[model samples]
Target: MSNDQPLKGQIIIFTGTPKSEDVFELVEQLGGTPISLPLIQVSEWIEPTDEQRLMTCPTYDWLIFTSQSAVESFGLKMKRFGVSPDAITSQIAAIGTRTAAALTKIGLTVQFIPTVFSADVFVQEFKPTENETRRLLFLRGSIAGVTIREELPFDVDEWTVYSTEKAVHNIESLKNLVQTEKSSTLLFASPSAVNVFSEEIAPFTGWDTYKIGAIGHVTEQALIEKGAHVDVIPSTYTLKDLVLELIK
Candidate 1:
């Protein structure tokens, strides 16, 4: 290991979707052996009623996305329908820098992103004042909480474009990995990851012996609710911040 490889020889497991390979790469760059065990899976919504809603959607003052999944799902659907973002006159908003990046990657411009990385913070920053209701469209996952919808001043026209569920792995394989990589650092990016780990992975013997890291307040709450001790939690909610916390 080199002088800069502070995490040399560490085995860090990322518990998120397959799109989280970037986190794994960050771990590798820090000289850690990254392990992938996706704790969540995303699928297309069964009845795309939201697509229809968007198709005939009236002019809105703002369109907001809280997650990258929302951006990818909505952008793909727009492509399929031959719809152009230029057709919509509404301003776009995102909850975090990553979400904003996802929108920019697909040729959409973001007008707002909260400095803090949560829906509540986003609402606090942009919530309309009394008697200043704005027409808004929100693209989100089915499992998302209603904090954004409830906190905003106006009623948001929502489109559930995707659904998120816990990903399942072979029990025996996970058991073996737990046993073999007993010292590995486990990372959770969302409440769903913590829930899935509690349901599927924590049953294995000595599960609590592993080091654990969480990305944000919500994920840390889920970890605590599951009786898991989070050894590391970033002050900021981003995955890169979590990685830096782990290195510390």
Candidate 2:
């Protein structure tokens, strides 16, 4: 292998979708083959009342976003309802850098971000201005936990803007890949994706047979709980950071 191609002959599989072109390009740049074996799919899931609530989102004191999918779904809702970014008077808080970037891409300014990306860290670190009736709205996915809503000491409302489901259709593709690539590395970005892979794929292709990479602690914990040994976890929770760790 050439000195520039540190990851030559390595096959890195990403178990989430829609696939990120940036991640794929990064892996290829390092002389690694990037594969997208999507185990979870996300889509917008808006209700009739959600439209009304989103239209009046400016009334809230703070808007919390935990994932990029939530931010994308929120942007879609704003476009659909004709809600202009200039009309938003509420301060925005994102869980991590990627979520913050997604919000900023839609012309919304983020006022706060936790030192850590996890919700548990966010709850402990984020402190809104003290008010008698501070209202916080969390734009979340259907499978998200209640940490933000239950832990925050404010009147927090949640809008399930997106839903995630197992991408079972890709199971055969995963099996095929596992059969062919004995030394491939599997990277998981979310606990949901880990759960899906653990349930459907792990039984067929033993968990310990491949090197595993988790984007964050939550996903690492999920893999550990499922009897899978995680090989790499980046200090920073991002795809680029995770890929860098893998090459190192």
Candidate 3:
């Protein structure tokens, strides 16, 4: 234990396939030895059928993009089909601030951004009153879960821009780490990540020493339901806040 470290040699477990190493570096800066036990993995991909459908669509009244990956995946398919990104006239609806940045990077302006990031919040807060044609197109992942299930009314053309693959490396690493002293803190960003952790990481019973910290209610609820011992959660959803709370 160092006398100058804020985390004071705390062991931490990161549970999820991180998009980049920025978070890891930040963890190190906070004086925590992060255990790389990402529980769930996400890959960028699109279905052939969905790509074809999108290429064939005449036009859309609105285009909904929920994640950065959605924008990238769709961009790939559009490039493969020789479609111009500028040709799409439908105003883009971004789910979050990061997603809005992604759309802007591709030279598209966001016409709608809901108060919240979830699809349910997006649907409730979005007002289609300006346009008479209630048509929309959703660009999202294959395993986006049911976030958008009841969000749209009747039917909206959903373009499968990407598919989520369960990354097995996190669990494999977790199992190996569990063999040693469990001093790391398991951080779960989502409920799915928690489920995968509970199923993949061998049961600890009374021998486990890792503290679980879930980012949200959904994730916290999932962990408790699966009998995991959760330690902390911040009022905000950002990773920076989560880590900062742990530091405090």
Candidate 4:
């Protein structure tokens, strides 16, 4: 193996849909073969009430976004409803840097981001400007946790902008890869993806055969709960960071 290619001959399988192709290219640049075996699929799931809420999103004091999918779905909804970015007067808060970037792509400025990407930490650190009515709107996926809504002291309302479902079609392909590969690294980005893999693939391939890389502490905890040994977890909760940590 060349000195520049730290991941030479390594097969790294991404278990979630990477937000950008740069993550894949980075692995290839480092002399690793990157495989996409997405275990979870995300799609827009907007209801009439959700649309109404989104149309009047400016009325809220703060807008909270935790995932890029939510931001994408929200951007689509804004286009559908003819809601301009200039129409929104509410300040935005994102859980992660990627989420903040997505919100920025849609012409919204993010005013706050938690030190940690997790919602539990977000609630503790995020502070909104003092107002008489501290009403916040949380745009989230269908299966997202209630930590932000339940823990925040403000009057927080939630809108399900997206839905997450297991990508069962990839299971057979993942099984084949696991069976054929002598050694591989599996990267997990979300707890939902971990749950799906734990339920469908782990029973067939078992956990010990592969090295696990989790994007964040939440995913690491999920893997640990499923009796999987995590080999790498980056200090930052991003795919690029996870891949960099893997090479190290």
Residue by residue across 13-67, what tens digits does model 1's lDDT show?
Answer: 7777645468778888889988777778888674646557667544777888998
The better candidate by TM-score, 1 or 3, is: 1
CA lDDT scores, all candidates in order:
0.79, 0.88, 0.70, 0.90
Of candidates 4 and 1, the better by lDDT: 4
Worst 10 residues of 1 by lDDT: 127-136
Model 2 alpha-carbon drift over 4 Å, by segment: none
Best by TM-score: 4
Range of the 10 consecutive residues with the lowest summed lDDT in candidate 3: 200-209
Query: 2 or 4: which has the higher TM-score?
Result: 4
**Per-residue alpha-carbon lDDT of model 2 for 1-248, expressed as tens digits?**
77788888989998976334998998899999999988999999978886788877988889999999998999898999888889888999999898898888998999999988889899998886697237889898999998999998787888899999999899889877976898799999999998988788888888877889998898999999999999999998888899999877
Q: Compared with the true structure, what per-residue lDDT tens digits does model 4 show for residues 177-229?
A: 98799678999999999999889988988999878899889889999999999
User: How many residue pairs clash in all the candidates, one count each?
Assistant: 0, 0, 2, 0
Name model 4 segments beyond 4 Å from true: none
Evaluated at residue 174, the lDDT of candidate 4 is 93
Model 4 lDDT on a 0 to 1 scale = 0.90
lDDT of 1: 0.79
TM-score result, candidate 2:
0.96
What RMSD, rounded to one decimal, does every model reach? 2.2, 1.4, 2.9, 1.2
Q: How far is candidate 3 from the true structure (C-alpha RMSD, Å)?
A: 2.9
**Which scores greater on lDDT, model 3 or model 4?**
4
Clashes of 1: 0
